[model samples]
Target chain A: MKAALGVMALAAALVLIGKAERPETGWSFRLPPGFPRPRVPADNPMSSAKVELGRRLFYDVRLSGNGTQSCASCHVQSRAFTDGLANAVGSTGEIHRRSSMSLTNIGYASHLTWANPLVDGLEAQALAPMFGDAPTELGLESAAQLEARLAGDKTLQGLAQEAFGAGGLTLDRVLKALAAFERTLISGRSPYDRYVGGEVSALSPEAQRGLELFFSERTECFHCHGGFNFTDAFGHEGAEPERKFHNNGLYDLGAGAYPKRDQGLIEHSGRPEDMGRFKAPTLRNIDVTAPYMHDGSLATLDAVIRHYEAGGRGGEANPRRDRFIRGFILTDEERSDLIAFLESLTDPEFLADPRFGAP
Target chain B: MRSLLLSLALTALPACRQDTSAASLSTHRLRFIATLDGAAANCKSLAAPPFRLRDARLFVSELRVIGPDGETPAAFVPDSRFQSVEVALLDFEDATEGCEGDSAEHTELVFEAPVSSVRAVTFTVGIPFALNHQNPALARAPLTAGAMHWGWRGGYKFVRIEAQRDGVEGRIHLGSTGCEGALHAITSCAHPNRGTVHLELDPATQQVALDLGAFFGSDKGGDKTDCMGEPADPSCHAGYRAIGAAGKEAARQSDSLAANTTNPAMGASAFTVIRRTP
Candidate 1:
């Protein structure tokens, strides 16, 4: 019995020694050329173990209260993290008012979701889908319920232990892990990116013309959907977070109103000037994450171009429309060229990357 | 852990009241109750035809007690979950039947005030501007409650009165509207939506009564839909009128609370003060 106890003690010491030798590797981003390091919260630093655990949780259906769906259900990786639906459907079959936003370079966004200005951090934003009841996404009733579900699974608990160092699985830890993984969904390898990287043949002549139109003052597409991430609502390590919302004049119920249910920034601010203001989503992977607009009212890229060309549904009569959204005439050839340029923004390699996929 | 903290708070209350120094600070407890036309009502027994209460909660702040001399600021005693120095949350729903958030039932506002005969009281039914737009994930209790949060708009509902009448659900969520600015640098909210209530109460008043009938009443030809506190929402007229915070130009554009529908000639208060028998 004494020999058996001695052997057990020896085994414990060996395990401790093995753990001490196998140090955790520090995480570093293989950022695309010209891309800056994404801004991370001071509380949640990046780690390989945490990101791996987050990837597993991101695809785990048990995260939902009913265990019917996961984050991947609405944010499918192949479709640039959007479900390609007009409105997102929750785990319990409740239809959401807004569409699923693409996760492509979401870490760079100064704000999260379609319109909320306050939700800037990914950790804070993760709480909405997991426990938000206004058309519940993950449909979790409470944090205790989520904790119980996560603690019940041995594999998940082991992963949590690795990521968070023997601390029990918790909501804050889960959110941090999920956010760490989401930050790694960097997409900057499109044909447009290649063209910018000195690859002259990366873009066709038609796409090149479309790109010019997109950047030109006539279309003014680059005004909002500009910069490396193709959006004005961008932030990085040393940059002051940009908060820009515009009214594209999608609808005019009466007196420059866009649907009563969703009046964009006005719904939050209650200011008359903010009637139809909405964030211009990153144009990266915009070709796949359709239907377009805040409410997903527009069907295709052609329809979007037409809406912009016509100066929105209300035309010049829309009092709340952005100054940049003035009427512009685009030829059929120019329109098709613009669509081709948007398609060029799609990064096939990033879409098919196994690193961002379910573990 | 929650119940233990609550018991600690309850235990601390009696000790505070035991202080007998002349003209010194003493704890004043004001219990709140929901009523269907002056009759006590809750999630379990709301009304006939079965009115299912989903959520009923409101934030009360800037509390002051009216004395013979003047108004005295009644500072809320900081509690573990619901009461803070600046604000107090009165949650009625018990997470039974249709109720879907925190099961903790909080319906009292305990505050420290100078010992005096309280004849009336005044307070605002809304979240303070400073704490309104803060990140809820990092917020302390009462503010951290998910059901009370208006996530899409980035604020807490100042007043949430939700129920189903004959299987048809109608919800009234009142919060600041036209709120502009980033999380930290909030410029301003166009419609602050903070309802100011001044009630005349007897010294024996034990409960602050909220009339659900007045809240659910529709002045616009019985169009009882969900009111998300949007100025464009015609459905909000009834709620705003009931809360005595409605303005003629509110639906269009006006930030004047003086132009509210609460007329002096009506002689009606936003909330009625009553004494509930133990």
Candidate 2:
């Protein structure tokens, strides 16, 4: 009996040790330089089968209630996953309140949506576009409906079996697969990245000057839109989650109110002081993800720069505006240099990569 | 491990026996019906030919039975997918006619209160701020229903009533607006937007009439405006007033016109106790 108990104790210890270390096999991430491994939820572990299945589902229109749209409808690949619309038009032709955000390095986002701080997980965030009815993106009503639509497809079923370990197609499985695939969308091969990697000739002289201006105290561009992912709201394995929203002084109807239709973080926070505050989206693919701002109000990089230089459209009167957005005069040459720097951050290879493309 | 198991077993005993403490509490079922011009309206009755009821679902919270002794909070039983101890979703659409989704019609609020002569009923017409702004993906029961989840707002729609007339659709989607903070740790809401409702109940049948006509307003056949609780939208004035959201900033938004004209305090008149004939 003592020997049997000793064997059981050893087995338990081995299991605990195995779990404490990094996963040895099954699915491993080919993370880029200066990038930490993303924090994957234990419930939905990383798997190659799940990623493949999610790639298929991400582009499948049958996942929608009307069979007219899918996740890809608004999140196009070449455009850094943004539809390039001022407002994202839903599958049912309903216009969304906010612009479609870029999915570039979305796995690193601490909070999922443009403003909702509680939507910290990609699995939970997937439900918004899939089943959300306010401006119905995918417009799917129920999981039963989704299951019924994909039930006949043998390819999805086989993939689901391999991905989920013998379970038939499920909504939970679908979400996990999508999140798994999204975690693999790492873009760290831009000119800026190359420059930081010690390649002196990666960026032009003008772009290097622009980079200095961006990080300078005058522009203060690097405060919210800083760090590896270029957005303060970044998280990873064992990293502290930063859920930050800022008011770039987009509008002030009377007080610090934004457009009534979409008032940024204030709509979620419900605080008077939080008016017009919105998450600073990553500048990773900002060149491709325009017109800028929450509403896509800025038409081009030049306009966005000018808006920032002028201390936002609301002017200095806006009390709730982020202090970093204080006005600064930028010469025409300096302006183009900054734009060059922003453009250099765009990874052309990542955009055209078939891995993220439709199957 | 044996001592730990014994302590856990000791803790579990009270939870299992806790149900017995509520044995004296009597179950009270309140029937709520949608009415148009004082007539009971359903999806079957209000098809596409006339004014079609697209959807009508409201969250009733903080329900209490006002008796002679005092007010006692109604302990809502986990009877259906439409109810929970924290809040109850009173759905009026059966997903027929003009209704959009697969929503089962549920228009009852059943709760357990002490056995006493109930004098009146009081409840809020929306969800509490705490329960309203959480992640709906992780919500349970009636909160799990997809049709009521307002993702962009980071909260559940407190009240959703949609109707179509003469090819024009009118909507009243109410939720907490100008809210501050993250989802789980929301600090405050500028406009709670909840309507306070109180009514004297009949001793026999506790039936309440949800006057849809009042919600749509007396104006019929003309252009009916929608209100998503935007302060700038003047269309929200009548609907907010009828729901008795009056003095709250939720309704005070359209009251920008109040500077010029005198407007009476809005009372919660959308719901009223009906005396049923035997």
Which candidate number would show the highest TM-score if scored against the true structure? 1
Per-residue lDDT over A87-134 for candidate 1, one digit per residue giving the tens place of the 0 to 100 score: 999987888888899999998899988777767788878877887666
Candidate 2: tens digits of C-alpha lDDT, residues A1-359: 35323433432332222122255358766665556777888888888888999999999998788899989999999999998999999988999888999999998898887877667778767877887766778888766678778888999999999988786887778888999999888887898777776675898989878887887789989798877777889877777788899999888786677876777766554567778888889999889998888888888999999989999867788888899989899999999999999998999988998989999
True contacts kept of 1: 0.35
> Could you tell me the lDDT of residue A136 within candidate 1?
75
**lDDT, candidate 1, at B91:** 88
Of candidate 1 chain B, the 10-residue stretch with the lowest lDDT total is B260-269
Best by DockQ: 1
Q: On residues B119-227, what C-alpha lDDT tens digit does candidate 2 reach at each position?
A: 7887877776657766564567667636677665556777788888767888877776655455434556556666778788844575888887666666564476676
Give me the TM-scores for chain A across all models, comma-separated: 0.92, 0.93
lDDT, residue B241, model 1: 61
